[model samples]
Target: MRRSVLVAVMAIVSTVAAGCSSDPTDPAPTTSAASASPSGKPTDISFLVYGAPAEVKAYRSMVKQYDVDHPGVKVHLVEVSSADAALRRLRKGEVPDVFLMSRRDLGEIVDAGINQPIDELLDSRGVDFTDLYKRDSIRAFSHSDRLECMPYGISPMVMYYNTNLVDFSEMAEAGLDVPKNHATWTFDQFAEAARFGARRGAKGVYVDPSLSGLAPFVYSGGGSLFDDDRDPKRLDLASDGSLEALTTSLELLRKGAITPTPRELRSTSALDLFKAGKLAMMAGFRTLTPELRRTPGLSFDVMPMPALPDDRTLGDASGLCISAKAVNTSAAADFVVHAIGKDAVSDVAAAGYMVPANTEVAESDAFLQQDRMPAHAYVFNRSVKDIVTLPLIESWPALERAVHGDVYQLFYSRVIDIEALTKKIDEESKAVLSPPKASVTPSPSASASGKN
Candidate 1:
């Protein structure tokens, strides 16, 4: 259940997605500055984000428009498929002027010094910065203290179910009132119910490898990821509370509840399986929620991730950040600010995702005025308010690579003991962030990205 973060998987086909082609309602954008940046020159901003080339193409189009409208700014788009690739580029000084990345990736950049503080830029323009969603608007920078990044688009966790495979009537027969679409339920109850669906022959539920689907358990189970001050971002993984949270996922897998799929599918197309009616409950973020509605044969909607015994604080955090070395910092800032304001927020809401990150966007007619949201939408919102992004300290990426490599081994290999697994991970993390033992503590704060 510790396997969760504010960022979720979204395999949006850039060429066709709301990214590349501008919708009519989209605000007009061009790359021109009303005045010269203090730097006194047009900026050449290189933007990097994760996705296939198609997505990058869409970003390129928008960035190109930004460059054109702003006489002094030029933009470049760089695409990478995995978090590792992005890190490598940052380490090699091949970093772009600006970057578009997941919160997880931004955490890595924050330590690398690849991220530039944005306050000065905002101060320069005298922009008040009050129009954004409070959660995304503030926590993004607050998560790491010192305001490291901003949120561009956000997708919250959602519960996706395949009604065809699940017989809601069984609950009625058992005197259990099964919740209808968009209805909320507790984690314990949901697990019990998923077992019900499993007994009836449907894959009761699935948790893809991505963090989006797992963090809810931590919050709902009364587990806290870290102590008050996030100095040593400790692993509450084995906490008794988290153990209870972990049991939910463990139960689903042990009961033969879900058909195993490759992690790549979880990242790229797990929704396709849910749409195929292969699952009763598929935990995912908003990006995967709409397919349940769009698919003719599937009846499903969004729901909260679920609550554990007395647990309540769900991990959630998202924000957009401009690259420190961005050739066009001012122009990039404009795009990010605008994207956070209205246009991009609308796209996110219209796509059936969570409320927009912009305060106005969330309250707009498009958000508040909508009715009959997919199942789980409201519950999901309840958790979204208290979201905690994974700590993005300097060693996080290295720590992530180590944990990712080890967790799969432990899950699949029976020979490894839990103690041994934890030991291996702890040692790796400590080594990566070597504490100050009279000079042994290698600063997790490595040089800024693009410095090579």
Candidate 2:
């Protein structure tokens, strides 16, 4: 009964996974053929996908195109409301030959003993791994260092500043400089400008306490919250870099240079205030671009997370995953390859959906010219060299919750001592992450592997 309930919950929600920070000590990924064999050619197979209307439409078009190119193969596309819905179908014996999902979801799928690695499939079909731009993204979906997903979207967290509230002219008059090049912007500069903006009748910078929003500050300062994502015991949030990041944020809050004041630390509120022109600066990923362009009377631009020198930000990718239970693995792998191929990636980018994971496609003008509203859309790729992927840890969801609980406490005035709070986070996170652990509510069950 417990296993059945866990599987049902896993079928209902595909949680949004947090990303990893920069790591130099990590080993490189090895490309080897998987042991699983692709099923022989078949005329029919299920293909499941989930997304908003436009994204769904975009994928349907791609599938149609693939059908047109393949004479004998017929791929049936199922549009589900969520990854959970599709997985529920899969569990009920409606297994899909190919499915679209976040790379983060790979762990749960692996844990359930469902999907097969695509290494051998790629080799058999001659899919070149080098064609993908973000190798880190590909690695994110791997289990025991074997590929299980074909990456499509590379979403990097970036800073969006409202020009209306920012008043660059006012900043210039106040002898403050706008960040023309993100590489040189420091935490001191960010805080100073926020204070200036606050005095000028604009709310200063506001960051939601989520790991994605908070990690950039830690990363820009050259600190890491976790050393090895795979190691439940590893923590560096108390390190000098982490301390500096936290201290700067607290100081800014105390000085009235930021918002979500201990009382307003709500995630959605940051975007709401940003759109209402109440905020001068906010942070988010490329996913926010389309919706941001739809807002009226807002002049905004995108920039890499401002840093002391070579800055970094959280990176995540979503793409195609094939099931081990797939009856036609050959056709499934073919569709997977086609879905992330040059033509398909170009179409996805042209729609301004996301940054393609293909090297040539990402560098193409299709994505770069997709919008002019964020005059600095080009800068989205400028920091490609600094993209960091989150580790593929089964314990991530539990650790994320434990860490975020403390973050909200600190942001909301419930926690005054930053050091003490972070230490508590480290403790709670270890308890959640430790193997052979005591009983916990979530219990690292099917949904525990699911996003949330």
TM-score of each: 0.69, 0.79
CA RMSD of each candidate after superposition: 9.6, 10.3
Cα deviation of 117, candidate 2, in Å: 1.7
| Model 2 per-residue lDDT tens digits across residues 1-452 | 00110112111111111121122112112222122234544367678887666777887888788677665567788998765576567667666778877665556677776778776565445555543445555555555545666667777777788866665577777788666564446566676667665645557777666666677777777777675555435456777778777677666654444565654544447788778777778777777777777898888876677774447777756767788878767667766766766777787777676877777787887787744667767667766556655555554456667678777776666438888877776666665545455565665676668885
Summarize candidate 1's per-residue lDDT along 1-452 as a digit string, tens digits: 02222231121111112322232233344333545566787655666766444334545556666666666655566778754677688778786756655565555566566778664444333333443335443445533234456555455565666655555676767876565644456665676567666644446777643223445665566654433223444454456665566555554543433544454355545456567665677766654544455677567755566556542433333445666676666577665654454654554455453455555565565554346435335544454554555544555546556456665543344354545554455455554444445646445565454366
Clashing pairs in 2: 11-84, 15-451, 20-390, 34-120
List where candidate 2 sits over 4 angstroms from the true fold.
1-42, 81-95, 167-170, 182-184, 199-201, 253-257, 262-268, 308-310, 435-452
> On a 0 to 1 TM-score scale, where does candidate 2 land against the true structure?
0.79
Q: What lDDT score goes with residue 264 in model 1?
A: 30
